[model samples]
Target: MAKRIGITGNIMADQSGPFPGYNRAYVNNDYIQSAAEAGGVPFILPVIQETELLKEQVSQVDGIILSGGQDIDPLLYGEEPLQALRKTFPDRDAYEKELIQTAIAMEKPILAICRGMHMLNVTFGGTLYQDLSHASFAEIKHDQEKDPPLKTHHVSFEKGTRLHSLFGDSARVNSFHHQIIKETASTFKAAAYAKDGVIEAIERTGELFVVGVQWHPEMLTKKHEDMKKLFSLFMDAVGT
Candidate 1:
């Protein structure tokens, strides 16, 4: 059987109308395509309210991938979002958060991208930069020009970490956000970092394999060998 990969959809509203409608719910194609191209099945899950429904949806999948999108509600981490901060999707956030927590407890493999990484951090008592200049913006450009999602910069890996073992040495990936990882949570270990000293990737400390990348590897999965390696690694972990 093919490895199953359940991805969290993005919560976005279509502002094309005079009044924004209920279009703030969708998943990224790259996220789906990456899994398919890597010999895994891609499953896009919409934001749901009922925890039982969310749990049942994830129960059938072999792995979970959280894609990039809007900022998480600061209230989740115990704070108020600033003027520059983007509001999170309450339904989407609730669904994915519970999905991730449950998935982890179930010992399922998880791969989080961009904002998804931020969500993972916040879920574990970690905090974010909130805004690029909230503290310092000397860091590399968070949003990339080439890929716009996660195909734009190079980052260094911390030696002897899960990310290091997955994609060894130095790696350049796409960047696409203004926020960066600030407070490292006890549940994770810093894996890779940007030249500006920003945390670029993190791995769950125990039970199951969860690696969250600040960049979007899915955007380059077809053309990039290491990117392909990522999904393969995650799928491998899933079957185990």
Candidate 2:
């Protein structure tokens, strides 16, 4: 049986059609393709405001993938605005927060990426650097500014960590995030770090299948088998 993977979708402006007032819910094809390649049935989960509807979706999906998007609202983590802070989506934040909480409570596997990683941290009472400039290791070259972004750095995983188990001790991965996980949630353990000591990956401390990575593994999966392994590992946790 194929496991159902519920992926969070992003809300973006789409005013080029006859109906020009409404924003559209979208998920990158990379996320969908990656999940499918991992042997799971991928589906977009719109930001449903109805609590019961959201719960119903969560109950059906075997796992959740919090797809990458805009910055998280600092207010969610009880912080004031920083000049370096980027645009945030409050409605998406609220929806995903509730979704994450429900998923964790039910012990469902979660794989959070990029902005989703930051959201996961905040949801668990942890905090994040509003921007890379505010982080302790601000010197790290985390913001890979290229026309079409490419892998530029290697992340060294802690030996024996689940991430290390998937990609060995160190593996080259694409970098595209500015914000870094400053203080991980109490329930999660920092599993990987970059050369400049930025937190690159984290996993739940206990047996719960929760993992978050700061890089764009979905993009790398097309060429790098190791990156694809991360998705495969998540599927294994989902236990199809």
Candidate 3:
């Protein structure tokens, strides 16, 4: 049977006017395409607050993809918002964080993208830089680089780690993030890092199929086979 993958959707940027006033919102196509490429059935899981409703979302899907979105509020990691940081989305934050936690509790496999990756880190007691203005030794331009053909940066995967197992020792990936993993929580292990020691990828340890990447893997899925490897591995785990 084809596996069911519940992808976390990016919040539609709707601030100028009243929301559609609908309960079941829709996810983007990138998530749906990625999951379909990974040989799994894709389902869009809308953002909802009721804690009990989470189980129903988890019950239908064997895995999830926490798609990228706006930067996480610095308050989440006990840090004040920096001047360079852009606007923050509280409702989106609340929904994704709770959705992720609920998914984790279900023991369903999850693959978190850029902001999604950071979200996983914070959920497990981790911290983020919030923004990259005065941080020393910062070299990577993770947020915006339109000149280059692809949207990625160099990342060094740790040896003997799950990320290394899936994509080998090193690879360049899309880097559409300014905030990054700072002090990671205990539940996750640093699997990959930027050239300047910024955490790029992480995995939940001790018998869980939780993986997160600080890049837009969904963007690279069409051309970068390694990105597909990341998704295939996650789907494969879900099958097990």
Tens-digit per-residue lDDT, 1-240, candidate 2: 879999999888866788777788899999999999999999999998899999998998999999998889989888998999988889999999999999988788999999888888999998988888886656868877773237788889998789888787898878887788888889888999998989988888878789999898888788878878999999999953
Question: Which segments of candidate 1 are over 4 A away from where they belong?
Answer: 13-25, 145-151
Highest TM-score: give the candidate number: 2
Q: Pick the candidate with the highest lDDT.
A: 2
Ten contiguous residues with the weakest lDDT in model 2: 142-151
The C-alpha TM-scores of every prediction are 0.91, 0.96, 0.90
Candidate 1 has an lDDT of: 0.82
Model 3 residue 83 CA deviation in Å: 1.2
Off by over 4 Å in 3: 13-24, 147-152
RMSD, one per candidate, in order: 2.3, 1.4, 2.7
Q: Write the per-residue lDDT of candidate 3 for residues 108-162, one digit (tens) a residue.
A: 8888888888888887789888777656667777776553238556889999888
User: What's the lDDT for candidate 2?
Assistant: 0.88
lDDT of 1 by residue, 1-240 (tens): 778888887656677777576566577677888888888888888788888888888888988998888888888888888888876676677877888899887778998988889889988899887888885744678776564444567899998887788778889787778888889888998899888888989998876889899888888786788889988888888877
Candidate 3 CA-lDDT value: 0.80
